[model samples]
Target: MANVIRRAEERDAASLQHLQAATPGMPEWTQVHWLGLLSGDAIVVIAETDGEVAGYAVASLLRIPGEVVAELEAIVVTPSHRRNGLGNGLLRYLLAEAQAAGAIRLMLEVRTGNGAARALYQGLGFQEEGLRRRYYRDPVEDAVLMSLQFPQEAVAVEKGQE
Candidate 1:
């Protein structure tokens, strides 16, 4: 599909809120929250085609003394746009940005019933690290904690020293 993925803007808040509402199991974020994130520390991107939003991804970083940890807050694609690689594209964008920002690892939690999302994460090199019981409401499901660790050796390879 001819979709463009770009940094989200304040004007995207309302549309994103609507999309989040239509997506089951997604946290309902207020327009104010979305607007605040536009200027906040999170890395947020949206995919659009024909001026219509197709998907979006949000990620935030936590800095430690020697390393950066990134959390994938959310990734959502409209039902009509599912299976077209929009979600994959959004996630790949976050992964690249986080790595460039010095993130040593990426983390996220998904409801156990979300097989599709879990599969996507695994396909992208995430592994199940732990589980939180009853971490998701509405249906009260377990949350599978997943993480992807970037190898420090990659720096040497990128620097042409390997």
Candidate 2:
């Protein structure tokens, strides 16, 4: 399947809601939240396959003491589209967007039971940083924190040219 990853627009709210509804294990975000995100500082991207929203990823840029960080808020893919690289595509797009926005690090938390997600993150060079106990409610699961740090050399080179 050919998948196109693009920035989400306000008009995509309904399709995003529908896609989220069809996906389990995703955060229950309201329409208000979706709209707010589209207008907020958060970076959101959706994967489209054959004219349908297949998956999406959200991240927020944060200014820390000495660096900008991108915190991955959510990532969800419809069940029927799993294992087809939609998830990976969404994540890679997010990473590129974050880096372009001056993020020096990308962080995320995933349910410990979600082996597939963990594998995906690891495959992309995200290292396990820590764990949050009882981070999820519905099933009372732990959350594994993972992070991918951009190479310092790359950041330095970019800064040097500025």
Candidate 3:
């Protein structure tokens, strides 16, 4: 099936909500919350296969003391769509978007037990940095923090690096 990845629109809120409901451990966001995300500063993208919303990913730019960092807020693919590279496509698109938006790094936290997700992040160059104790509550799982750093050539040049 042909897959299309694009920026999410307000019209996608319902589909997103449905996807969220179908996925366990995903944040239970109301349609209004999803709509707010589409209209807010968050970067949200969806993958459509055969005109159906197969998956989506969300990230937000965070202003740190001296630089901006992108955080992967959530990513979910319908159960039937898993293992088809839709998640990878959504994340790759988010990575490019975050870098283009001047973020120096992208960060995320995943449940320690989520091997599939951990593998996906590692395959994409996100390194494990640390862990948070009891970060998820449904079954009280720890969260493994991961990050992907973007090359800061511009910043280095500005700091007088050749």
Candidate 4:
């Protein structure tokens, strides 16, 4: 099946939320929250498989005094789409988008038990920076903080310079 990945619009929140609901250890977000994200220019990406949402990646930028960074809030892929590169696509898309927005760093926290997600982030250059105890409340899980620096290449990309 063909897959198309792009910046998520307000209309996609519904489908994206549904896909997210299928995943465990994730907080359910409301449409109002999702809409606010798109309207504010926060990073939100989605993958469409045969025109249906298969996954999503949400991130936000933080500017504290003189420092600015991007944080990945969540990255989830439906069971039917796991192990098919959709998650990686969504992640890389988020990294590229955030980098273009002047982000010097990309960070995320994944449950230590989520080996697949950890492997994916590591494969994308995100190294474990720390650990948070009881980071997830749903089933009570620990989280490993991971991060990757945006190389000079991030500034040299010829596409989507805006």
Q: Considering every candidate listed, which one attains the maximal lDDT? A: 3
Error of 3 at 93 (Å): 0.2
What lDDT tens digits, residue by residue, belong to model 2 across residues 1-162?
A: 678999999999888878777677676787778899999888999999998898899999898887889999989998888998999999999998888777898999999999999999999999999999999988899999999998876666666744
Error of 1 at 56 (Å): 0.6
Candidate 3 lDDT over 45-162, as tens digits, reads 9999999999999998998898888999999998889998999999999998887777888999999999999999999999999999999998999999999998898545444665
Model 1 earns a TM-score of: 0.89
What Cα-based lDDT does every candidate model obtain? 0.88, 0.89, 0.92, 0.85
Two-way TM-score contest, 1 vs 3, winner: 3
Clashing pairs in 2: none
117 in model 1: Cα distance from truth in Å? 0.8
Worst 10 residues of 1 by lDDT: 152-161
Off by over 4 Å in 3: 154-162
lDDT of 4 by residue, 13-80 (tens): 77876776767767788788888998996999999999988898988998767545899998888888
On the 0 to 100 scale, the lDDT of residue 17 in model 1 is 94
True-structure lDDT of candidate 4: 0.85
